[model samples]
Structure formats: structure tokens, C-alpha cells
Target: MKTSISKAVAPVAFVLALAFTLLLHGAVPFWGTPTLGQAVWTTGFSHSFVNHGLLPYAYDFGAPAPASIAFGLAGAYPAALLIALGMHPADAYAAMVALWLTVAFVSAWWLGIRAGAGSVKSTLAALAWVTMPVIWAHSGYSMLSTGIALLPFYSLAACMLFLDDVQGSRKIGRALLYLSSCLISVFMDGYSFMMFAMGSSIVAAYSFVMNHSTRRRLLTYSLPVHIAGFSLAYVLFALYIGKPSFGAAPLDFFRGWGADVTFFLFPTQGIHWMWDTLGLSVPRSHRELFGDSSVWKTTYLAPLLIAGLLGWLFTFSKSRIASAALIIAVAGLYLSLGPSLKFNSLVPQEIIETGVNMQHMPAELAIAPTGSALLSEHLPGFKNMRASYRWVALAAFGLWFLLLLWLSKAETLGARSAAAILCLAVIGSNLPHPQRYLEIPASNRAQFKAIDTMLVDDMREALQPGEQIAFLPYRNDFLVNYLAPSVPIRTYNIGGDKNLAMARENWPKTMRQFKMNKVDPAFADRLLWLLAQGEADAVVLPYIDMLWAAHAWPGGKIHQKQVQPAIDRLSATGLVDIDTREYYAVVRLNATARVLGQTALQAKLRQTLCLPGFCVRQAASSNAIHSRVGRLSANTLKSDGRRGFLVFGPYEPVESGTYLLVVWGRAPVPAGAWVDIVSSRGSTVHAKFSVPRTASRPDNILLEEKVVFDEAVDDLEVRIFAEEGSRIAITGYELRLARSGPDKD
Candidate 1:
């Protein structure tokens, strides 16, 4: 009776302690949500679910699919529930993390009991699992961190599937647990899914080899279930992505994001504040740590766990569990080292430099690639995964299992005392500094909330429900996406999903034309003409987006100088009415726009051949020249001494097929410059012609070229390559369709 009472009381005590620790860390159900990093991204998804239900648009102006499923489907239901209960999206996200963390802790403890640990040892192992530096460091990343938290649960489910000696209802329950865990694991994140798959496969193979009795059970129950569960999960994931392909992380990402061996021993970065406060700063002062980023340096293991792991490896233990643990731990660590070996961020230099023996030198940073490279290139699942450091999660779990084994062997009072100390050491070593908590100030949170409310109200006032809208500088999406949850308006500005990133790629190309001192009349007309055609009911220019784009674009200083002029030009087109606010402007189609159909709009946009000289960018220099000839004045950009690209750009999106480009510009004689129609960045040249030498006093040389675009292109530019020290002046140019038909691409 006393023992049962103690077990009951112990869990309550653990719960209280866990809550306090999470509170101190500013985790959710305790405080405000984080305002930085991936937290905002996670919050956006929760908000979408709360407002739009399950099949909300992912991004790129309502490209349909719940893109969040690819990142955090495991946490989506909980997040949605919290948000529905009036929690802020950020807080809801935090609550989801806290919930998973609690589940992880409970699962670890349960696994310990199943592994024959006493109550005290079980609690310690569970404590150690949740408080690992890797776990805490990744908490802000939503389901990625939750996936780490769920690893123990997955392990527990796998153990039961292979080793449990149950019958009838109990056996069915175990199978259900295994299936549920597998589904949740795969839904959580790819890293967690792959780790679970790898770890479980190892266990299954071992059981098959050693336990002949369990082989039929595994083949009959586990194999079929694995097939069914993984197949269903894949179909669900494909539906969530809305396509067969997922966002492909770049190849170099694998090399850059790989783990450093020393980071496993070194304290992670976020704990320095505690050391500084205690005057124990030396441990945190190392400036030469090798890793891609501070965030990736989160594989720190407790010193006690490391000693235990080493002891288990060296000892002559025939325990099958211990052997499996060692094998898994080594495999995980080796794979996490990625395709190279790194030590303290230092690489060996050539021995020839100091007349030192080559044998005395440290190994070079990277080898000429290895088996991991081949796996990443050719392996099915690995090809999609780039962050090899995440494999350390499996390593950490294996180490935790070894620690539990060690704990189970300790039977005396002194051993229990040592186990308690181990738990304390794990918690102390991994405790993140208070400043690491990404808590938003109450005032800032309230301010943002108010801004969102006002923006929603403003959008509603400007447009009717279901009206499609487009935001200017189209990539400014976080606030726009947040607004999506509250406003009834639909838009093309979706959250940052890579597949849809190119949905409106042509908008920037058109907007880039305005970077010059003055907007072209033809360009301004085209902008208005597109709007009048009703692709969207309105265009919103948020003050926040305008400010961001002013500094975020290339040649931003030039963009800043040209913004007002471009706005004025766009407004003067008179096709749409602008409703200006202090924080935003709404451009709505007027009565005149409603009457202008496709044919009239096309005729309006087809004002060809009047493009001015200032429209052509002087790639060599930014300075412009003003000249008057009789009654006519020209704004021309002169070339500097630099040899390449004296004139280029007005990079406008154009449909495929042949087009005529006419340039009225003058240059030094004897082929001083050559003009061509080329790809946006001038990589592919479509047509080229030499500039005609002009003996006239006034700078007027007519050069025309016919360029054929085999496919529709987003950024097509007319370029001029100049000889060194060649003087050139571009007066004007004209681009027109070589074939007469309505645009249909």
C-alpha cells in the first residue's frame, strides 16, 4: 500500500517540477509566446486552422494546400484547439510544444519501467531525456522539436511490438499503439520519421536473428502493419503537399548543416548567461566552435551520460539490450558526422609551410566525400533529407537507453544517490539561460494584436468578402498571412512555401522597371492595364511591405529614390482608385476599369516604341545625363570606363515567340558596342547586333534586332556590351510583338 502511494505521489511531484521548469524557460501554458524565428511560422499555421479549417490555402495567394502539414501535422490538431480556445497563435504553438514535451517525458518513464528500472531510476531517465540540450534548443521550431520529444514514445511502441508477450485484447492494443506511433512519427517531421524507421529496423533485424519464436509474430503483425501505416501516411502527405514533390533543400545544405564532433561535448551557446551571472564564464568563452550555426550546435550530451556510454562500450557485457544500445549509438553518431570529420573548426595546413612532418599535422577538415554522400545522392529517403546533424537525435536516444541500462544495474542506496546526482547533472548541464527564452514583451504583443485587428478592419472596409487581393512587393507574407485568419478577403500572398514561391515571380520583374529615376509611360500603362483586367479585385500596398522592399531589393538606394515617382505614375494612370491610409493603400478597380474588357485593355497596354532613354540601366554607372537638342530634351545615362554592359535592363516579362527590339543610341565607331536581347541576368543571348557608328553631331544611332523567345520568359532584357573606354548614349527603344495575336501563355 505504501509503495503504491509513493508511486502515485511521485508522478504528481514530477508533473509539478516539469511545469516549473517549463515556466522558467517561458514555455507555453505559462507565459506569452516567442516572437522570433520559426515561432512566427508555426503561429501562422495555427491561426489558419482556427479560421479556415483544415484545407486552408498554404501560400502564393491561396494556392490550395495546408503546407503546414509538411512541417507540423503532428501538432496541428492541438495547436488548432488552443487557438480556438482563445489563445494567441504564438501561445497556442507554445502549448503544443509543452504538450509534446510532457508526452515525451511520460513515454521515457514508461520505457524505463518496461526495461526493469525501479521507480526512482525510471524518473531520472525520463528527466534526462526531456532535458537534453538538443531537445531544449530545438523547442522553438514547433513540430521539429516535438518530433524529438516523441522519439521515446516511438521507441516504447517499437519495443512493445517486438518484445511484449501479450495475447488477445492486450496484443491488439499493442499493435494499435505501434500503428499510432508510426503514423504520428512520420507526420511529425522527416528527421524523426527516418530515425524511428532506422532504429526500429535495427531492433527488428536483431529480434529476427536471435529470437526464432518472435519471427512469425513480427512477420505476421509488424511487417503488414508497417506497410499499411507508412503507405497511408505517404498518401496523406502527398495530399497535403498538393503535388508529388516536396520542397527540395539544396545539396550544399547537407555539407553545411552536418554536426561537429566537439559540439557533442561542448556546452551549447544559449547557457552562457547563467555562467556569466555565476562568474563561471571560461567554459562559455570558446570562440572557435565548429558548426554551421549556433542552432545546429545542440547535440551536447551530459558528461555523466558520456562516461556511462564509454563504460558500456569497454565492459565485457553480453546483455543483448546493452549491445544493441552500443551499436545504435555508434551508428547514429557516425552518420551525424555527415560526409566529413570536423574537430574544433580547425583544418590542417600543408606540412611544406613549416618543414614539419606530414604525420604531425591534424587531419584536413573534409575528405574527398564518403558513403554518406552516396547515400544522400542515391538513397530514396536520404535524398530528400539534408540536415544530417539531425541524426544525432537517434544517437541521443540510444545513449539514453544505455543510461537506463546502467541505472537498472545500480541496486544499492549509494547507487540510487548517484542516479539522483546524474539526473541533477543532466538538468543543470542542459538548462537554457533565461535570456534564451524567446518571450515577447506584453506591450509588443498587444501592439501587434492591435495592428492585426486594425488591418483586418481596413481590408474589410476596402473590399467585399471573397474578393481576391494582391499585396505589393508580393513576398511580404507573414503579416498578410496573419491577416488571412481574420479577414474574409482571399489573396495571392500565401505563406512561404517554396513550390509556390514562383507563382507571382513575374511581378518583381515588372516592379524592377520602376527602380530608375522615372517610370516609363508604357510600363505604367501596362501595370494599370493588368489591374483593369480583373486578375485581382484590388492591390494592397502595406506600409510595412513598402518599408521592407525599400531596403531589401538590390540597388535599394535607387529604389528608395524612385518609389514616390513610380507611385505617382501608377496613380496617374487613372484605371484604379486608390484608398490611402496611414499604414496601407488599397487600389481598387474604378467604373472605368470595369468597362474596359480584355481587348480594350490589351490595346491600352500596347503603346509601343516610346520608352525613354532613362529606362535603360547603365550597368557600368548610376549617373544620368540631361541634354536639350532644340525643343527636345533627353535624359540619357552615359557609360563609365568599365567595358561590360553599358546599357541593359528594363527586364520585363514577355511571352515566347519573336519580338522586335529597336534601340536609338550612339557609340564610338568600329563596333564600339554590341546590342542583344538576352535572358534576365544576361546568361542566354537570343539576338545580337553591332551599334551603327554615327558621324552626326547629335547622338542618334538607330539599331534594331529581331529576337525569338522559344518559351515564355519572366525576365527578358535588351543589353548593350561596350568596348573599354567607349562612349555611349541610349536615347530610346521599342519592343513589340513580331506575331499578331492576343497574349495566351
Candidate 2:
């Protein structure tokens, strides 16, 4: 009963702490974006995991599939739960926050147990681990949130080491278990692996000193197998992290996290006092952290007192102290440079005139060192360790362990009271932070003015179930944000930042150079290919329109040629076509859209809708539509409650420049529509359809088809009529134009 009760204590505390974490992120509309001390790593991890099988869209570019099935599955946990229970993304994300906390709890408890810490000690250690100021920082700071997950696994590995040591087992079973953990750490992150190396170094060094006589025996036999297995695993997992460049290191390593460790416990600059007290802040510097929280600031609680008191009062051997210090040093350095003050972001990435002058280093730190090779040996599916921030977690865990050790010797109430006083003194003296205070609960975070309404209904309406898309409302796009918790609903897309990095023959061409390939190597060919393959689906193309400005294209096209090799393979299957961007949505026909649509177009549209197709407008009415999507005519049953003009087309594919679409119903560039022409070679040209500014104009909306064509083409594939199947009614028609030639520059 006592053991059970002890076990329950940490878990219960962890649950409460996690609940607090979720509530801080907001409950319903989970649109948390981490700011200064912004968690880029966390963002990447979450996105790569959540949007698992979707095409890459406007934002979520450069994301990779979860290399490992084990812990990499963390990203999908929240989405799966919410889905299982029929919950919304926001609720699912909130639940994820809770789930994340729970994972932290379990991991911490397991770590303590592994180390042979008694049940009570393990529980306290776990509680202390979750409540660390850094963990609190991540909670209040959404950007850093995903990175916290690494902490638990890290703790687990450390504890495993402790247990293995205690058992003094050089047996094969124990050795294999240790090796398994080494493999598991790789899936965690690149930094997690580094920390594991660091921590293991400390342990191994200590082991060497303590067991000097038996050291050779341990190192020669079991240790060799362990080391060999580890070496082989690394080569397999970290394939992408090829040839390291000792360039600049990562800034988050030191700056962003400084405030998390030493001072500014809740230095939420500029936020009110209430939230500050609860550990959430609305600092101007980290707006991404607390901007949406109108009611309650993202709240967090720092365990400064607990950690500090334990550090000062509890006595441990020199080795334990060193372990704690290393963790603090590494995590503290990263914090100091990141959230605390400033971070270096610029790197000269200019490609050389001859060969590439690749300055591939991240904004702050150098990529991991090289000598290592084998991915299968180190991390089969993923790198077990990375996310340097997790070291802070290990630091917290180490501190708690020492405290528990100290607590064990206490004989009376006086001794306990003495220890508590020491702890209180440390807590009181060491903690120096300004808190954020807000009147509302953090649950009611602000979206846009109508964002709450949109999330409740509009977002759902916007997305079709099983149709993949990214939902972003952050500095970066949603693919990089919401996808982490929403993983498995979709997959990573090479559409955004990565699109440029990608090419079509793009698959083989783009992937040929990488150390290890994406899970589905031929997975390249852009989000377009994946969509075509049914391996990928839709993209929630974020139409950058936050200011209520017109939603227009933020120009940048996908390079299908990069993944040509992958495309070639897919094409062989005949599920995909070899030529013409029309078969793939990215380079296919463009659609002229509005907020609403007209009666004639609506009739034509209903008939033309295929199992799935694209829209290409040949012409439109001259009247200026307000750019909405609904039935424009009064008699039609279709109506968008919010009236405006109209927009149409999830268009049908055109034969690129080969198809000459002569618009007769609407004049050249009709007022109600945008005449967007995409060439066979994948170039786009646009002309708006609007009312003529000419004086002698008679009709309110005259129909004119302005003829525009490529001077280079000898014969264009002509669409005989405006509708896909109907004959022409004949009025004045406008010829939609495309640019003259290949320079597409």
C-alpha cells in the first residue's frame, strides 16, 4: 500500500502540473506559438511528427518524417487521443499538453526506479523534475514545449545507467538492455544523443575511477559489444547529418535559455502581475509565447526553491555533483544566449560560383562532430538523443536524486525541519523573477477577433476529413506548428522552405546527396507527387491574409524536377503521368477565386466536378464580385450566408500552355475573376477580370475574352467552348495571356 501510494504521489502531482501546462496553452483553440527562447527544435519535432502523411504547404516546409516509431510517436499521441474521443485539434492539443506532462511523470518515475531510488524518492524526483523552472519555461513558452518531451527519455536513460551500475551486471541481458537504451536515445533528438554521450562519459569516467582493477575486464568484453553496437546504430539513424561543418553553433544553446536557469524565473516582460505569479508571462521580447492569451497569460511554476534547497542541503558524492553541474552548464549556456538576451541568426549560405560555399551551420551552434558513421548502429529509425535543453531536465532529476539521498538519513522531525529550512532559504534567496499577472484564465487565449468562432466551426469546415492540410497561425506556418500534436493526420511536405531545397528528378536529385534518405526515399517529388501517389494528400495552403487584406499568391513555386528520379519510379507504376504539371497540382492550371460565385458559373461548376479535379476559368462576368464563394444568383439554392461576390474552382487540369482557353462570357480579365495562365513548362501568368475603365462601356458587366498566348507556341491546345462539355453562346471573348518565353525570370 505504501509503495502504491508513493508511486501515485509523483504521478498525481505530475498530472496536476501537466494540466496546468495544457491550460496555459489554451484549452479549445490550441494555437500556441513559442516566442523568444522560441523553440525552433520543438517546432520542427512537433511538425514533423504531427502532419505525418500530408503534402508540404505554405509553411511547414523542411520537416522530416519521424525516423523512429518508438518515442517519435510522441507527436501523434495528442492527435490520436482527441481523434479517438472525437475532439477538435485545439482540444486535442490541450490534451496533448496534459499527455506530455504525464509522459514526463512516467519517464521521471521510471528513471528513479531504475536507479534503485525508493518509491517515495522516485515520486519526489519526478515531481521535482516536472516543476523545474526550465520545464516551466517551456510550458509558458509554447515554442520550447515540444523539446521538453526529451527530458523524460533522457531521465530514463540516466536511471538505466544507475540501475545497471547497481546491479553490477556485466551479463549479456543487462548489457543488451543498456545498448537498447543507447539506441532509444537516438530517436529522442541529435542533442539528446550528445547529452547521453556527455552523461555517459561522466558515468564511465566515474566507473573507471571506482572500479580501476576490474575496468579492463568490463571494457574488453561486454563494453566492446556495447560500444560496437552503439557505433553501428548511429551510422544508420543520423544519415541526414552528413559531413559536419564546424561552423557557428546554435543560439538556443546558450541565450534563449539563460533566463530559465539563473534569474528571470517568469520574466514575462510587460505582462500583468497575476500571470507572472502563476509562472506565465507576456514579455514583449517573447510575444510568441503569450500573445494569444487575452484572458490568462501562459502560466508556469518554477521549482527554484526545491532545486536550490536540495542542492545546498543535500550531500552527494563528487561524481553526482559533477553530473548535476555538467547538465546545468550545458543547458545554462544555451539559455543564456537564447531567451536571456540575444542570439546570432545570420549565416552566409551563398552557393559558390563553382562548388557550393555551404555555410550549413545553424544560427548558433555547429552540427555534431563527424568521426561517427553508421546510422543502424547508433539510432536505427531516429537519433535517440538531441534537444540540448533536455540536459536541464537531467540536471533537475540529478538534483532531486541527491536530495532524496540526503532525505534518507534523516532520523527525526528536527532533522527534517532543518533540511526544509535549508531548502526554504535557498528558494527564497535564489529565485529572482518578475511574474506576469492577468485577469483571465489562460484557457481563453485569443485567436483573431473572430478566431474563436473560426476554430469552433470554420476550421472544421475548411478541412475535409482524410484530406491533409496544415493549419498555421504563427510566425511560421501551421505545418511547423500544429502538426506535431496533430501528427499521423498527415505527413511532412517539402513544399515550403524545403521546396527550394528539393528538385523533381527532384526526388533522386534532391535525395541523392543526403546521408540517409527519408523513410520513403522516393518520397521526394514535392508535396505534389505525394498527393498524386495517395501517400500524401491535401495542403492547408495558408493564404497569407491575417490583416483582412486580399488573399493573393505569396509567390514561390515547387521544383518538381529535383525529385525526377522519385517521380520516374512512381510514373513507372502508371498511377502518375510522366509529363505535364497538369497531372500534379503544383505546376498545373491556376484558379481564379473569389469569396463567392455567380449563378451561371455555379451551374457549370456542379456539372464539372470530378472525383477530384482542378479549376481553370476561361472567362467571367464584368461585374466586380467581392471575392467570396457562394451561389451569386437569387434563385439558386446555394448561398454563402456571408454575401459578397463569388470565387470558384478547385479547378480541373489544363494541358499547360498547350490548352488555349478562349473566354467569351466575360471580357479580357473579367472583374469577377482572375485569369491565371500556367505554362506547360510550369510558369504562371495572371490578368485580373474586372469592369472596363473605358468610357463607352454599356454593360455593368460586359463579357469579353481577351486573347493572350505564348508567342513561342505554334499550336495551342484550344478549348472550343467556355464550359467543359457545352457549346459556345458567343459574345465578345477575351484571350487569357501567358508570358512569352522560357526565362520565367
RMSD of each: 7.8, 17.1
Q: Which residue segments of model 2 deviate by more than 4 Å?
A: 1-73, 77-87, 91-97, 110-122, 140-153, 162-185, 213-236, 239-314, 317-401, 409-415, 418-476, 479-745
Q: Write the per-residue lDDT of candidate 2 for residues 126-231, one digit (tens) a residue.
A: 5555544454444433424444444555545444443244334545555566566565455333444555555555555555566666577557644565565567
How well is each residue in 130-244 modelled by candidate 1, as lDDT tens digits? 7675666665455777798788899888888877767798878887888788778877887788888788888877777877888888898876766666677667766665555
Which lDDT values do the candidates have, in the order given?
0.61, 0.36
**Clashing residue pairs for model 1:** 59-494, 60-492, 60-494, 61-491, 61-492, 61-493, 61-494
- TM-score of predicted model 1? 0.77
TM-score of 2: 0.46
Top-scoring candidate (lDDT)? 1
